[model samples]
Target: MSKVPANEDFYKVHLLNEWSWKLTTPLDAQPHTIDGNHIFEVIFEGNNTDTVCANDGHVELKFAISAMEQRNPRMPRLKFVRGLSTQFEFAMASLHTNFIRGRFGLQLLFVSNESVIPGEDFRLESLFSINDEVTPGIFEMVNIKLGERDNSTTSTLKSHSNTPQSSWPTGFIQARPVCYTSERYREVKASRDAKLSKQRTVLNTSDQELLLPRTLPYLFYAQRIKPTDDPHEVVGMRLQNISFGTPGDGYYAHSSFIVWTISFGFGEPPIDTLSPLLIGLITLSAVVVLGSLLFGTMLILIFQRRYRFGEFQRLTETDTTSAVST
Candidate 1:
């Protein structure tokens, strides 16, 4: 048997990042059906070849809901299950009592224990992976605004400190690792210990905290689903507002990579409707056109008045000259 080339290996690993999934509800079909017992199915299909290997690799699925009473829970309700093999179903009846008329955020995350080996590096880049691409923040203190807080009270805070304490952004809750095997767990422990051992000096409490590593357990892929045309539909309820990424962070450091939005409760996926961004663009174009017309009319009036005034001055000069000659 011939050994696979490096390029071929890279291609195989790249396929793992190319996987995608979709959400379909009964409301999506023709003659839409939506009730209290409605079910939302996620169809995940992807090519996973043998060349892509991780020690304890698996995928996870999560669904987050936001509505009136429980609006903006610190952490979303999560479901961890084997991903990319088959269709997964979530019965709305099991999760909610009456019917949840709110926005749904569906996320898929990939977790693996393949990075513990020292000197043996695994390429961390993925379509869904979120990490700093350039130099990390240079400043010790960064000023940020938390939700609805007075701008005057906003203060400069440290990004990461060597102290015993740390501050997370608003609405962010700490989470523990969810999926892993015993062997992987041991390896992670060993690797963490080895890394910490190198820093032997007993420095200040802040210095110790600064030496700690920030570990992101999962890399995510996400989508937002909004309500459909029908008001009675159980799925695709109206969304007040939806947002992706973390506040003050340029990218979604802990959140999922948002792909796009999907609509349900309609017969067919309606044409990608105009977005608020598009509407704003159209309004701006109209304003510019009207402003240009008004400016042009004003310029024309000014030019006409100047021409008449010059003609009157010329006529007055000619009359004065004739009088002088007489």
Candidate 2:
């Protein structure tokens, strides 16, 4: 069938095959761009040309299956999507703004041609990170605490997830993101702006919240932090272990979404919340100091009372002697 939405460019889908894409639009270099592409070129479809633009160049995907099964027992899977469906949609508004939240936003949607099984979800491990490099002071991974909010309370993922994060805080301190220039990729660097310190990034309360990806309630957004340390780990988040769909569950049985908005090049990534261990230590110290003060106050009162009592007795004896002499 012909592609829908007449004004949009056609995107081809693939199944059981390795595919690539290149955007028809040429990369333009000027203000924020060094070449035709934005300095931090967000790429898709394993295609050098499919760079995401400020335009709502949303790509849509669907899956179709044949009755006749094709066997490839000898071939090992090199990528997750190779064995899944072929079509995909990278949806986002092409809004370009100076603010980090406004500048970059993207989402990937995947639907099933057939019902899926438990533990049979498409996933991409280590989506993006520079950890493969031998360079020093470099690693990758946005250290999301084990119990961070992986999904909304009403989200299917949250209900189905074995790990409950109802009590966990949705905060992350560090992530290593690399930007793609027209030429190549490079590691992100941290800034030593006066407002930042190792303990925290933003000095001002308003700016502190600015570090959060306030734009959307993304599934995972450790992609950009204002920058805790210069090195983003060898970690890029791609689709990972989405087991929401099942063959007989009905409406949502065959589809799952790998949705996230990029919070790159912002003022600072969200800073770390105080750990329980630190909070406990502070509380213990306060208790100790207060106990010492209370003990010292008691000793001072006792000494003062004793001194007054002894002086009063001496005065009484002197007055008695003077009366007898008179």
- Candidate achieving the largest lDDT: 2
Q: How many pairs of residues collide in each model? A: 5, 22
lDDT scores in order: 0.25, 0.28
Instruction: Report the error of model 2 at residue 18, Å.
Output: 13
TM-scores of the models, in the order given: 0.25, 0.24
Reference-based lDDT, residue 68, model 2: 23
Q: Please give, for residues 1-326, the per-residue lDDT of candidate 1 as tens digits.
A: 11226765221112224434333323355223323323334333332323221222223332332111111111111211122111122111111111122112222221211111112211211121121111121111111111112212332232334742123322111111111112122222211100001111112224223322232321120111112232222111110112232223332221212222211111111112344765788789999999999999999999999988887533576666765433
Error of 1 at 115 (Å): 46
Candidate 2 Cα deviation (angstroms), residue 114: 17
Model 1 ranges with Cα > 4 A deviation: 1-53, 60-268, 314-326
Which parts of model 2 are misplaced by more than 4 Å?
1-45, 50-102, 108-276, 279-283, 303-307, 310-313, 316-318, 321-326
What is the C-alpha local distance difference test score of candidate 1? 0.25
Ten contiguous residues with the weakest lDDT in model 1? 191-200
Please give the lDDT score at residue 154 for candidate 1: 31
Best by TM-score: 1
lDDT of 1 at 155: 27
Give the clash count for model 2. Answer: 22
Q: Residues 211-249, candidate 2, lDDT per residue (tens digit)?
A: 234433221443332223322221122221112112232
